[model samples]
Structure formats: structure tokens, C-alpha cells
Target: MALDPAPPMLEPPAGDEVARLRRMAQRQWAARRDLERRLHDGAALRVSALTLRLGLLSHLHPDEARDLRTAVEGIQDELHLVLQELRDIAGRLYPPLLDEAGLGPALREAAGRCAVPVRIDAPDERFGPDVEGAVYFAVLGCLSDGAATPVEVVIRRQADVLRVLVSGVDACDAGTIHDGVRLLGGTVALGESPAGDALITVRIPCV
Candidate 1:
């Protein structure tokens, strides 16, 4: 019997391709940071100021027509909501906590907003911006997968490698997470826990 032709071997990315990917990632991060800053300093501030002014107007018109006072209060409430929404969008673009505190605290803040329970165990030590950003978003993406099960996340640094393991979240889009991590010279693996829950492992060089 004739032997089947050997399968082609997969080649690692060339040095130039890796460099290109890094450049793209850097540009993306920079853009996100810039957009966040604009939202924080520009739209959010303006809306907040307007809300305050409307409050003051409402007070000034207390003796005026009741409908006028009600209109001002309504506008103030809408503006307050707008300001909050702007802040939320800016945070989602690039969290200020991620830059100020580091990965552990940032993740904790994100977990607090999740519908299901989330447990995070990460060191307070800092890593490079790229490393921390990639890991933060990767974990966040998994948590946002809308799974009903509680999630457990653990992060550890060994020598130059940073390892993250997340369990109890299945149905996460592996391709999206893989692409984000791969851009930072990391690998992502999806498996099943002993109890059959989803397990995701990520490893990246922090140096």
C-alpha cells in the first residue's frame, strides 16, 4: 500500500512578521489610550459641568414656575446619566486603574461588575504595560463571555514567564483571546477541568 503524503509542518512567524505584529499592537494601545484621555478630559468634564450648572439653575428657579424647575431638573438628570456613560466607555477603552494600580487591582475592579461570582488571585507586583494590558483584557474577555458559572482566576510569575489560569468559564471565543495574547508573544490553551468546567491557560514572557 502506498504511504500517505506527510503533512506540511507549521512554521513559526519570521522575525520581521513578529516585529510587525508588535508595532501594530503598540499603535493599537496608543490609540486606545488617546481616545480614553479625550473622553475623560473632554466629553466627561463638559457634561459634568453642564450637570452642575443645571442643578444651580434649578435652585435659582425654585421661586419661578414649577414646570421650569422640573424641566431643569430633568435635564440635569439626563446629563448626569450621560456623564456616567461617558466615563464607563472611557474606562472600557483603557482603564485608568490598570495604569495606576496594576493587574491585580484592575482585575478586581472588573470582577466586581460581573454578573457571576469571580475570584481573582494575582500578585500586586507590576509588569510591563504591554504584558499587563494583554493579560487584563484576555481575562476580562473570558469573564465577559456570559457564562453563568462562577469563575476562578489565578496569576503567577515564574522567572520571566507570567502564567494565568482561569476556570469555570466555557464558551469564550478562543480565537479572539488567542489573537490578543499572540500579539504579545503569548500562548493560549483551552481545556477542561477535572469537574468538566472550562479551563484556560495563558503564558507570556514578561521581560
Candidate 2:
């Protein structure tokens, strides 16, 4: 089947969205740090409280004390899990290694989590934040499989220009990827190969 061109007037990225994303990213990072502090403090408090309870419960039947101990242990395990999950979310927000790893590693990590595999080929050089995020989501949009098909994403950089090509599964409107590419004042192209792969190309200036 032929892939239809993306909506001609695809929704542009709203200014509000850009501001909101920036604020949210900052808030989330702060919250993560605060949560880390709280976790450690809370754990300390819980241990103290549990110690008091253990003292009181020790006088009861041995079985009762054992049950109380088990419940306390369960609580500790749950808190630990919560703290770990929070850390993971914070770390992924703006990966620490983003500068060192460049866009390719981050894109690979994002694609790795997709239900369908996404193949990405990107430059080893680093790009600006807006350019990086644009490149990241340009490929990410395909992960939704809104058309119920798979996709392949290829990213390459030449001097100050970066190109992102996505093709596979159903052909999507150029409009579909255009807005995403436009975030960084880039251009996009959407097409499908004869063999049933949809393709999207995004070219952005790295300056």
C-alpha cells in the first residue's frame, strides 16, 4: 500500500510547549534531588521507629515479634524500590553521559526500549540541546506504531547539518515529521520504498 503524505498543515510546536518542557525538565530534576534526600532521611526515621516497636514487641510472644520484624523488612524493601525507580527517572531526564556519549548513544537507549526495534545511525559528534531533543523524538514518534507498523531511523551529521531519516512500515505524511524537524528550523521528507518501508528525512542546521 502507498503511504499517504503527512497532514499538509501539521501542528507547529507551540511556544508554550517549549517553555513548559524547559520548566518541567528543571522541576523534575529538582524534585528528584529532593526525593533522594527525603528517602535517606525517611529511611533513617523508619529504622528508628521500627527499633522502638521491636523493643516493645520483643516482650510479646516470639511469633508476634517475628511477624513484626517481617512487616518492617517488607516496608524497607518497598522504600528501597521506590527510591531506585525515582533515581532512574531522574537520570534519564537529562542523561549524565549525554555530553560524553553524544546523540547516538542516547538515541540507541531510547530505541532500545521500544516494543519494536528501531535502527538508528547517527554521527559521533555532539549537537545542541534543541537539536539533540529534536533528533531524539523525530525517531521516537515512530515507536508509537500509530499506523501499526515498524520503522527504521537513520541519523547522520555533516559539518553543521544533521539528517534524520525514518522509513519502514507504513508511509506517513511529510507533515508528520515536519513539525518535529521544524523545532530546530530543519526540513523533513517522508516517503515509502516499494518494499513496504516508510521513510522520513529531517535535516537541521547544528548552529
| Top model number, TM-score | 1
| Model 2 bad stretches (over 4 Å) | 1-68, 84-92, 95-100, 146-150, 173-176, 194-196
What TM-scores do the predictions have? 0.83, 0.58
lDDT of 1 at 22: 68
lDDT accuracy of residue 119 in candidate 2? 74
Question: Where is model 1 more than 4 Å wrong at Cα?
Answer: 1-13, 192-196
Task: Please list all clashing residue pairs in model 2, or write none if there are none.
Answer: 5-173, 6-173, 6-174, 166-200, 167-198, 167-199, 168-198
Most lDDT-accurate candidate: 1
Write the residue-wise lDDT of candidate 2 on 1-207 in tens digits: 999986665565686565565455445444544554564457545655665665566556567777776876676676666656655654444443443476789778776777765777777877765566556655656665553555566777777788777776455545756766664557876666666576766788765
Clashing residue pairs, backbone N/CA/C < 3 A, model 1: none
lDDT of 1 by residue, 139-206 (tens): 88888877688899999999989998888887465566787789867888888878798788888876
Pairing residues by index, what is the TM-score of model 2? Answer: 0.58
Clashes of each: 0, 7
